[model samples]
Target: MTWLIVALVLVVAAAGLLRWRRPAWYWLTFGVTLAALRVLVRYGSVMDACGLTVPAPRWRLTLARMTNRPVPGPRAPRILRFRVTRTGLVLRLKLRPGQDAFDVAASCDRLRHSFAMYGVTSRELRSGVVELRMTGYDVLKRVQMPALAETRPMRVPVALREDGAVHYRDYRAVPHGLVIGATESGKSVYQRNLVAALAPQRVALVGIDCKQGVELFPLARRFSALADNPDTAAELLDALVSHMQDVYQLIRAEQRITADVPDAEIAADIWDLPENLRPVPIVVLVDEVAELALFATKDDEKRRDRIITALARLAQLGRAAGIYLEICGQRFGSELGKGITMLRAQLTGRTAHRVNDEASANMAFGDIAPDAVLAAISIPTDTPGVAITGDSAGGWARIRAPHTTLRQAVNVCNRHADLTPDLPALAPFRPALGTLAPVPAPAVESAPAAA
Candidate 1:
């Protein structure tokens, strides 16, 4: 007994030291707490008391008792499993017959208070199962994502979700996305992580950096095409639209509705076609979209209108053509001019880092999740990679990407430069990549000269 007591004391000391040194370590100690069982019971009791449980109808109870049948009391959700991670505890609960996951999700705040846990969020796992994520601490402060293995083609892990899962930028799922952040608000860092993750993939990259290519040029080895100025950007966009049209033509030709193919399997996106016949997917990265939207003179205005229209078209129709857009800017607002709102609406995925104002946050998440606006704007200025990300589903989460330097991203791109694909349409806009071997010296016409 004495030795057991000493061991317990030592374990407590070690946990306390770990908590003091590394806050993330504190989360690991939660699983071993003896109070966990007690807390579960207390949670169940509190849930019943708070009327969260679906009680047996009074008629049924009375009828059963009158017939001398077994009268069952109200049924409460049963604890299925609990697992601890570096950020939080995931508690799975088995719902009663009459109760569903929505009942639990609707009363999550009350559940959090009753359990005395940090933050409690719930999501339906399967039909009758619900998973509750209880975050012990803010995981966004120090982000460290697990090593990513590209499970699916073109799916790049961009950030660590609050629940300690990797969040992916899956072009197949969301073809176009909008990123908004203030200067020095970790937008560049996030893009760096994204580019680094994508450099190794078998996809073509195109960049338009109006900031004199300061942001995207260093990683140009992986980009098949790049545009650094307004005039060049306009031309590049036009070329992409032409390429998109050609791809659509190819898809249409290959798409023959026959008895062999099911209606569901009919070619709608690039993935639906055969691998050999499919064209290379292109990811257009637009750094500082505001640069392309704002103009001064009439010619500039015409140029701006052209760029915006091309971008809007790509967002609307590029998914089926295997063209995706990643537009990043310090600010996105209607003030940029007409078509800005239309373009923003087409981007289904929204990610906003620390912004200078609420208006910038709203520009990213206003139409989807108004609640996330405050969270995006409230991100600490010092937290570089922290962000609020949401999809069209109206769900949002606080995520953070690991710090990836520009040099690292550049190195990755250079190492994989040979993997860059050949696209004839983009050949004119293709950057002078370092992967191409020097052209053989022009053949000399020695015999003719001698004659």
Candidate 2:
């Protein structure tokens, strides 16, 4: 009897040691074997001690039976099926006669938590089924594995999200953003992508390209107005401001006269105004913003000052009025002159592409994230479309705008063109078209035809 007791103790100690020192699979094998041996030797005593009992695996049998169910005509199956996947998991569930995917997702939380005890996780594949994925003990190490999946439009490359969806984080929420990049740094491509995406919507497009209309003229077909120089830009902006004022007045008029209108019937913005009073939301794109600041002589300095003051006012008040700015520039620093820094402060969203100088990058991301300036400067010249973006929330992200060409942007603009409106406030600032006329046209024509 004494020898038998000692042998039992030794066996129990060995089993515990194996479990502690070996892998889970090895421990499972050893434990099952030892338990089997104990059951054979001790018979009924061992069974009673462990309270061991075996029940038929009903779940496995039920699954098998469900799989064999015959399909009736073109109708779908009733049971959902799913398989675990490498990156995440895949699920395929057949909906019940009246059930949908949302039903399955509703119960996923409980299922996930229950499976967590076994180092397994489950998520709703859809309304009908769920997927179970094994989580290794060393889960953190597994996460570091090189990503094998290819980047798709639905996938965000950075840790932050920029999937181009018109959700809270995207166009529907922010409405506008300012992008700063030097020449050859791919700012134009980013602008092109943004315009291409937004053009399909009902928003009106406005462009101020001080590059002699070379960069944006092709897109004139879509743009309500395209200003080629500072003088024209000032006029175009003043028109937009007048348009904004009208929108505000409309809002105020609606607020004052309360009707038995439904919640949805209330006019909240330009989009919700009555058809007659509805002004389309304008997305103003400014290219080479520095041109709006540069002055060749002291005589022209006053004109530049007026332009700056107008832009600053727009940047400060336009957002709530539904006239948003998307200002692009090669440089946007204090060196640009007095109002430049003030203008930068009004731009809540910042995207800095590869810059020619650190100072330009600092101008874009300095007050927000100084480290992001370093990252922007380090971006390789070859990677023109890649940029560092920061928002008013102080969150930063890296994004690469898909390549876009000048022609594509022009085509987008041409498609959205509408009859331009005149701004009376800007009448004095409008550049004299006569002064821009060909020198020979005025001189020769005025001399009279030599018939």
Model 1: per-residue lDDT, tens digit, 310-401?
99999999999999999999888899999999999999989998898888888888889998988998898778888999988888988898
Question: Candidate 2's residue-wise lDDT over 150-186, tens digit each?
Answer: 3322111221112221112254356556788878887
Each candidate: what lDDT?
0.85, 0.60
Per-candidate RMSD, Å: 9.4, 19.4
Candidate 2 weakest lDDT stretch, 10 residues: 159-168
Model 1 worst lDDT run, 10 consecutive residues: 29-38
Scored by lDDT, the top model is 1
What clash pairs does model 2 have?
A: 80-93, 80-94, 81-92, 101-127, 219-410, 221-414, 222-413, 222-414, 222-417
Model 1 bad stretches (over 4 Å): 1-9, 29-39, 57-60, 63-73, 80-86, 97-103, 126-128, 148-150, 434-451
**Using Cα atoms with residue i matched to residue i, what is each candidate's TM-score against the true structure?**
0.87, 0.56
Clashes of 1: 0
Candidate 1, pairs of clashing residues: none
The CA root-mean-square deviation of candidate 2, after full C-alpha superposition on the true structure, stands at 19.4
TM-score for candidate 2: 0.56
